[model samples]
Target: MKIVTLDAGTLPVELIKPDYCESWVYRASTTEHELLSVLDNAEVVITNKVPLRRAVLEKLPSLRFICIAATGYDCVDIDYCRERGIAISNVPGYSTRSVSEGVIASLFALRRNFNEYVRAARTEWSDSDHFCLHKSPLKDVQDATLGIIGRGEIGGAVARLAKGLGMRVLFGERPGQSVTREGYTAFNETLRSCDVLTLHCPLTPETREIINRRTLSQMKPGAMIINTARGPLINEEDLADALISGRIGGAALDVLCKEPPAKNNKLISLPHSNLIITPHIAWASETGVNNLIKGINYNLAGYFGGKVKNSVI
Candidate 1:
């Protein structure tokens, strides 16, 4: 069998090829223009983020199976793949622990003013009159109310961690969902009451740019926001404006609308010590990466053994 891995560079570690494979091609990345040409003769393809829409899939008659290297399979056209008899699989739950921990870490950093104090230590501490410097107000995590937007594995994990730290966790129902579930708080109510709001939902048409100006206005003044989920869930321009206007307390984002964001990205150059932006590494802990690679290998093995595992289609 012939196998091609598009965008192999996204994964820090190399993928182990199945022994039955006849040919394996690992390209760093496949641009839109080069996608069709590169995947012309492959029987199976592995992709992390390179999109495989109908236009590209229709031309590749040889393609049989696709193993998405990550949990979210939004990069592929699922309906078309099912129609074309193309099998689709994805690795899920591998990064649940890693991402949940990262969210809590970010929460502590933002709430306690870690960055501002670090800056003060180097620049302003020397001129201080007292033994300690009070550059920014520090809040205790114990009594804070945390609002989580998703009820998936990672979201549940975050809730458990927060509760252990003496926090009150509220799971928010879907936005505009008139009927709230038994254990969930109304979406709007969660917005108004939460001390810290964290997003763990998927990116869908209904959720894209969900945190716009109007929604941000509904949030409690000086409340913080954390996103370890999809980037586009929060509107970047709106977030930047809120931070600049001092309406929102702070924000820590592990994902952006555009990965490896451009120079002119609204939040890139903001001079706020309260805002923290990471290069989408919340799911990249050492254990998380190993679990992800193992999941991929398991899926590949299942495919060769005549029963595909983690099959999404």
Candidate 2:
């Protein structure tokens, strides 16, 4: 069996070559122009973010299985794969602990004004007459209401961690549904009540741009937004406007609409200390990376052995 891994550089950990493989090739990254030639005659392929749409997949007659290196498989065209009998597998829940921890850390950082104070320590602390140079008000995390959008593994993990810190966690209902599920708070109510709102939902047609001008208006003034989920979950331009007008307190985003976002991205140029944007590293903890590697190997071996694990097809 011929195996190829596209964008292997995205996974920092070492991947063990399967003993049952004849040809195993690894590429640091694959460009759109090079996709056809690179994947030609490959029986199996592992990809992180390189897209495998229907148009691209139609040309690859030799492609049999796709091992998505991450939990979110939005990079691939699922319907086409299903139609063509191509197997797809993704590693899920591997980053539950790492990503949930990142949310808690961001919550504390934003609510407590860590960034502003850190800047003060460097620039204004020495010159102040008082021992403590007070600037932004620091809010306590305990007894604060936390609204979680998705109740998936990572969202549940975040809720557990928040409750342990004495926070009130509300699981938001589906956006358009009027009937509130037994364990869920109404979507609008969650937005109106939460002190901090974090998104863990998948990006679908219903959820794309869920946090826009209308939803932002419902949030409590000075409420913080944290997104470790897909970037399109929030409208970037609207968020930038809200932050500028002080309608919302702050936002910490691990993923953006564009990864390695354009130099001229609106949020990238915001001069607010409250907004925190990271390069999608919320799921890159050492332990998470190791678990991902194990999951990938398990899926690969399982498929060829006739029992598929983590099968998406």
Show model 1 residue runs off by greater than 4 Å.
Answer: none
Per-model TM-score on C-alpha atoms: 0.98, 0.98
When summed lDDT is taken over every stretch of 10 residues in candidate 2, the lowest stretch is: 174-183
Give lDDT for model 1.
0.93
Per-residue lDDT tens digits for candidate 1, residues 241-305, read 99999899999999999988999898989999899999999999998999999998998888888
Clashing residue pairs in candidate 2 are none
All models: lDDT? Answer: 0.93, 0.93
- Give the lowest summed-lDDT range of ten residues in model 1: 174-183
User: What is the C-alpha lDDT profile of model 2 across 1-313, one tens digit per residue?
Assistant: 7898989989887698999989998888898788899999998999999999998899999998999999999999999999999999999999999999999999999999888889889999999998889999999999999999999999999999999999999999998788547889999999999999999999999999999999999999999999999999999999999999999999999999988799999999998988888989999999889889999999999988987789887
